[model samples]
Target: DAAHTAMWERLDLDIEAHDALLAVLGKFYGDIYLAQEGRLKGAEYLDFVLSEVHGLRIKELQDAKAAGKKIVGTFCVFVPEELTLAAGAVQVGLCAGAKAGTELAETLVPRNTCDLIKSFIGFKLARICPYTESCDLIVGETTCDGKKKAYEAFGEHVPMHVMEVPQCKAPCDRTLFRAELVRYKEALEQLTGQTITAEALAEATKVVNAKRRALQRLAALRAAEPAPISGRDALLVNQISFYDDPVRFTAKINELCDEIEARITKGQGVAPAKTPRLLLAGCPMAVPNWKLPYLIESSGAVIVGEESCIGARNTRDCTDETPGNLDAMLDALCDRYMKIDCACFTPNTERLDNIAAMARDLKADGVIHYGLLFCQPYAHEAMKVGKAMDAAGIPYLSIETDYGMEDAGQLKTRVEAFVETL
Candidate 1:
C-alpha cells in the first residue's frame, strides 16, 4: 500500500482505477486457482495456454492498450508498481506464459546464472511476450546483482531504467532508505517524463491502501473453506496482482470461487493422498523445488502444506496496513515475507523454530530444504536447520540445486537416502 501510494503521489494515477485493477488482478488469481483445482491439466484462458504463456499479465497489457494506455513490462523484483503508476504507465512483471527458459538457457545468458534468471531472460530472448517489442522502456531493480548486470547488458537492447540499491545490512537506516527512495523517484520521473507532488503522495497512499486491503482479503479467502487455495494455485495468484485490470479482475475471482465450489461438490478438488503430509518451507520455490513436491508424493509422502513464499507465505501474522509511511510499509512487507519464507533465510534459532512448528502442524515425517548451490543464506544455516530437525527427531535434508542439469542425479541419490533414513 505504501508502494502504491508512493506511486500515486509520483504518478497522479486514477486511484479508483488502480484499486479496481488490483482486485481484478487478484481475482484472476482466484480464477486460475479454481481452474487448476478442476484438473484442467494446463494453465489456459479461453482454451488456449500460450503455446507460450502469458496469463493476467497479458490481460493487463492488452487491457491497458485497449484503453490507449502506455504500459511498460520488465523483470521481477525491480520494476516496482509504484513507479509505473506514478509515471502514468502500468508496469507488468515479466512472468511468461509458456515459461520456456531451458532453450533460452542455451544462449541468452551464460550457464552459471540461476534457472529462474535463465528461464526469464530466455523467455525475453525468445520474444514470447508481445509487449517486449512494444515496450517503450524496460526497467530493473537492485534486489539481485545478477538482474542488475543482466539489465545493464540487456539495456542496450531496449529503453532501460535501473533502481539504485545501496547495500544496507542489519537494520537498514530510514534516512538512507529515503535517499534511495528519492533516487528511485528521480529515476522514475526521468523515465516517465512526469513529476510527483506532495499532494499526489497523500492521495497515492489512499489508492495503495485499497490494493493492500485487497491483498489482505485474498489471504483471508485462502484461510477460508476446505482451504480454497493450494500451493500450485497460490504461485499463479500472487503474480496476477502484478498485472491485470483490478475491477474486472475482482469479478473474475468471484466467478472462480463459484467454479471451485462446483469442483468440490464433484469431489475433484483436493488431491487424494495416502502418504504422510509434509510442509516444504523456504525461498521462492517455483524453480527446482517444483519437482520436489511431486517427488515426495511419489515416494509415499503427501505434501499437505507448505511455508514457501512461492507457496503459502501469506497464511500467518498479517498486518492491518495503511501507507503514508513508505519505509515502515516496506519493512512490514519485508518482515512478513521474511517470516513465511523457506529455510533460505540466514539460518538462526528462529528459522529452526519455524521448521519444528511446521513439522508438528503438518504431521510431517521430515522437512526438505531446497536451495541453489551458491545461495548465501541457505549455505550458512543448512547445518543448523539440520540440527533443529534432528533435535526434534524430525528428518530433513538440504538439497543444493543448479536447475534441470543432471546435477539432479546426485540429488536423486541424496533424496533417496533421506527417504530411506525416514
Candidate 2:
C-alpha cells in the first residue's frame, strides 16, 4: 500500500484520522446499508468506493498530475464536469458531509448557517479534506445568499471560481448563464493550458450523459413496490457518484440496476410489502448526512424518491449529446442546469410540480419535506411546498434539522407519527 500511503502524503492528509473516519463509516455502512434485506448485486463496489474514497481518487489524481493534468473540485451540481473533462482536467466533489470540522467552520461563519456550507469550510479550514487539498481550483456557485458570502471567505483561502447562478429561469437568465459558462470555459482553458474543442466537449457530454442515464435507471428501479433498494443505499450511490471515476461509476450503477431489475422480477425488496412509501423533498443530503432518511426508513416507511438536489434533481436530466458544436453544448448544459428547481429561484413552481409528479408517479403515501436548520431558501419554501402538497392532496411533513443527533429522538417521534397516519 505504498501508493496509498504516498497519495495521502502528497496531499498532506492525516492518514490516521482518515482511517479512523473510515472505521466509523464502515460500522454505519454495515448497520444502515448492509443491514437491509435482500440487497442487490454490484452494491459491493459502492462499498469499496466509500472505503477508499480519498485513497483511490487521490491516487488517480496523482497519476493525472504526473501526466500534467489538473484537478478541479466542485461543491455544487451547477458546476458541470463536462467542461472540466473537455479541458483535459478532472473534477471531484469536495467533502461536505462530515461533522468533524463544524466548530472550526463556525469560527469563520455564523454558527447558524446550514451544516452543508459549514462542513465545506470546516474541511478546508481544518485541512482534513484530501479532495479539497488536491484541487487546482475549487468551483463555487451562487445557489443562495449564504454560499454567495461563503465563497468570498472561501476565496481568500483557496484558489476558487464562483459561477453566477441565476435565481430565475427567464430568457434573460439563460443568456446571463450562458455568458458565465463561456467565462468558465475560458477559465478552464487558462488553468489547463489547452483549448477545449467542440469534439472534446461533445465526447465529454456523452460521458456525463451516460452517467446520468445510469443513475436515472437506478432511480426508476427504486419506484418499484417494496423498493428494490433502500433509500439509504440509493442515497449513498448518488453521493459516491459525485466523487468516483465517471466511467467506472456509470458501469457499476448499470450493473446495480440490472441486479435491482432482477429483484423486482422476483418481487424481492429491502422494505416489507405494504410499507408506507415516502418521497423526500428539499435540501441536498450530502454523504454522511443520513440522519433523516435513516430515521424515516427505521420508522417503518420506505423512501421511494427524493426531490432534493442530491437525488432525482441531480440525475433526472442529461445534456443534449446531439450538440455538434461547443456553443450548442454550452447551451445544452445551461438548459439542463436551469431546469433544476432550486428553492433559491423566485416563483419556483417547477420544484412543486416535480414534487407532485414524483409523489404521484412513485405512488408515495406521503412527502417528507426536509430542510436543514437555518437554510433560508428551503426553510422559506417549505411553507409554499406544504400548501402545494395540501392542495394536491399529498400528505406532507416538514422537518427542519441540523447535522447533530440532538434532534433524533424528536424527529423519530414525529416521523413515526407521520408514518402511522399514512
TM-score of 2: 0.97
Residue 334 of model 1, lDDT score = 44
Write down the TM-score of every candidate: 0.65, 0.97
> What lDDT, from 0 to 1, does candidate 1 have?
0.51
Error of 2 at 43 (Å): 1.0
Clashing pairs in 2: none
Q: What is the alpha-carbon RMSD of candidate 2 to the true structure?
A: 1.4
For model 1, how does the per-residue alpha-carbon lDDT over 238-262 read when each residue is reduced to its tens digit?
A: 4454444544444444455555555
lDDT tens digits, residues 282-401, model 2? 999988788899999999999988788788988889988887777788899899888888898998988888999999988999999999888999999999989999999999999999
lDDT of each: 0.51, 0.87
Best by TM-score: 2
